[model samples]
Target: MKLTCIAVDDEPLALGLVCSFIEQTPFLELKGRSSSAVEALKLLNDEVIDVIFLDIQMPDLNGIELARVLDARASKPRIVFTTAYNQFALEGYKVDALDYLLKPFNYEEFLRAAQKALNYKELINKPAVAEAKSEDEYLFIKVEYQLVRVALSDILYIEGLKDYVKIWLASAPKPLLSLTSLKALEERLPARRFMRVHRSFIVSLDQINSVTRNTLHIGDINISVGEQYKDAFNGFISKWN
Candidate 1:
C-alpha cells in the first residue's frame, strides 16, 4: 500500500529535497509540504496523512511540540524527524518517531527510514483476532526485529536508559530490553494504572508497595520521584487515601 505523507521544514531547500525524495520513492505518495508547523497541523487536519517528514528545529512551534500534539490525536500519523543536529534524537524517540534522518543524509538513508515506517504501519494495522484474551492488558514490543507480547500486569516498572527502556517484569529473571524511550512507553500504558514519577522511571501503581515523600518502593527497589513530577505523583497518591 502506498503511504501518503507530507514534508515540513523551515528551509526551502531542505523541504524541496525531501519532497523530491518522497516523489522518487515507489511506496510513498507526497500529499503536501509546509514550511511551518502551524501550517502543517492544518494540513494534517484537512487530509489523511500517513507519515510526516518533519524537521525538528523550526520557527514558532517546533517539531517536537508538534509531534506531541499529533501523538495525542486518535488518528496520528507516523513521524520521521529530520534535523541537522543529532542531539534531538532522544526527543524524536520521546514522540515515538519511526526513524530519524540526520541532515546531509542521502536518498539511501531516507529510503531506509521510509521502509521502517512502512513495516511499523503493517505491524500496528494488522487485523485483530476474535478471542477472549484481553488485548488491553498486554502490549506488543518490538525486540530485535521480533514483536514480543508482554503482559502489562507482569510489569513492575520501566527504566529508561538513553534510547533504550528496560522492562522489569515479575515473570522474568532479567528485565526485557527494548529500543524505545520511556515517554513513548508511558503513552502506551493505561494512565490510571501507570505513572511517570521520574524522568527515567515509570512505575505501575499496583506494584508500588509504599510511597515516601520523594520516593516509591516497589518490592526491594526504590525509585526517586523527580522534583518536577512531585506534584502530580502526590496527586495520584492523594486519590488512593
Candidate 2:
C-alpha cells in the first residue's frame, strides 16, 4: 500500500534529507513539507496523509505536542518520529508512534521504520474478518473520555485495584485506568491469549518474558502470581514447557 506523508522539521537540511529519502522510496509519497509545526498543521488540514515524518525539536510547537493535537482529532494519521535526539524515544512511544528514527539515519533504517507505519496503517484500515470468539480477543476501553480500541496483542498486562483495572499497553507510557472489575475483565478476555496469574493481574501470554515460582516478568514490571491461581498457572507453564 502507498503511504502519503508530510515531513516536518525546523532544519532545512533535515527536511530536504527526508524529502530525498521519500522520493527514492517507491511506496512512500511525499505529500507536503513544513519547516514548523504550525505550517504542518495547516497542511494536514488540507490533505489526506497516511503517515507523518516528524522531528521532535522545532522552533515553536514540537513534534510531541503536534502528535497530541493530532490525536485529539476524529481520525489522525500515524506518526514516525525522525529526530536527532535520542532522549525523546520514550516520549515518542508515549504518543503511540510507529517507530523512532534518529537523524542521519541510513535508507535501510528509514525503510524499516516506514514499513512499521505501513503495517500499522493496514491493521487499522482492514476489516475484522476473524470471528469474535466467546471470549474477547481485544478490548474497547475508555481513555480520556474516548473509547480507544486495543487488540489483545497490544496488551502487556492488566493491574487491578478495588474497582479499577490499569491496562499496561506495549505502545504507550501511562496505563489506561478504568472502572472495571478484574473478574468482569477476565470473563471477556480470550483464555488462549490471557491468563489470570494473580487475583490482581491478568497478563497477555505473548508478553510474558519469563516466570519464576511466584513472579512473571512482563517488560520491566514484576507481577506475582497469586497462590490461589498457582494450579492454573502451573498448567499453563506445563503446556509451554
Candidate 3:
C-alpha cells in the first residue's frame, strides 16, 4: 500500500529536497508541504497522513513541540525528524519518532527511513502479516538516480560519516553511499553475520581475512575495534576460533 506523506520544514530548500525525494519513491505519496509547524497542524487536521518528514527547528512551533501535539491525537502519523543537529535524537525517540534523520540526507537514506516507518506502521496495523514474514535478506538502496539491489552476503563492512553510511562491498571497488546511520544499518543486518567492531564500523564476519589484537583485516582493508565494542568483538572472535 502507498503511504500518504507530508513534509514540514521552515526552510524552503529543505522542504523542496524532501518533496523531491518523496516523488522518487513509488510507495510514498507526497500529500503536502508546509513551511511551519502551524501550517502542518492544519494539514494534519484535514488530511489522512501516514508519515511526516519533519524538521526539528522551526519558528513559533518547533517539530518536537508539534510532535507532542500530534501525540495527543488518537490517529497520529509516524514521524521522521530531519535536522542538522544530532543532539535532539534522544528527545525524538522519547516522542516515539520512527527515525531521526540528519540534514543534507540523500535519497537512499531517505528511502531507508521511509521504508522503516512504513514497516513499523504495518506491524502495528497488521501484526499477523508482519510476523509471518522472514527476515529481509536484501535491500534496494537508491544510489544517485538509480536503485541498486544489495545482497546481504556481498557486504564487507559499513562505515558511518556524520550523516551518511558507506557500504563497502567484497566485489565492488567503490563503496555504496547512503544517507543513514551505522546504528540503523546494524539493526537491519543479521546479528549472526554482522557485528559492530567500532562506533563507525560494522563488519561482515564472512569477509574477515585476519585479526590481530584490536584490528581486523577484511581483504586489504583494516578496521579497528573501538573500546566500547572491544568486548563484543573479542567474544565473536573467540567463538569463531
The lDDT of each candidate is 0.89, 0.84, 0.86
Index of the highest-TM-score prediction: 2
For candidate 2, write residues 1-241 as lDDT tens digits: 8999999998999999998998898889999999999999999999999999999999789999999999999889988899999999867866767778988899899888787677666656665554344126567664432245787888999999985789999988989986667898888788988999887899998999999778889878899988999899888888877
- For model 3, residues 93-120, the per-residue Cα lDDT tens digits are 6677878889889998999998987776
Which of candidates 1 and 3 reaches a greater TM-score? 1
Name the runs in model 3 displaced over 4 angstroms: 127-241
Assess candidate 1 and give its lDDT.
0.89
The top-ranked prediction according to lDDT is 1
- The candidate with the higher TM-score, 2 or 3, is 2
lDDT accuracy of residue 195 in candidate 1: 92
RMSD of each: 7.7, 9.2, 8.1
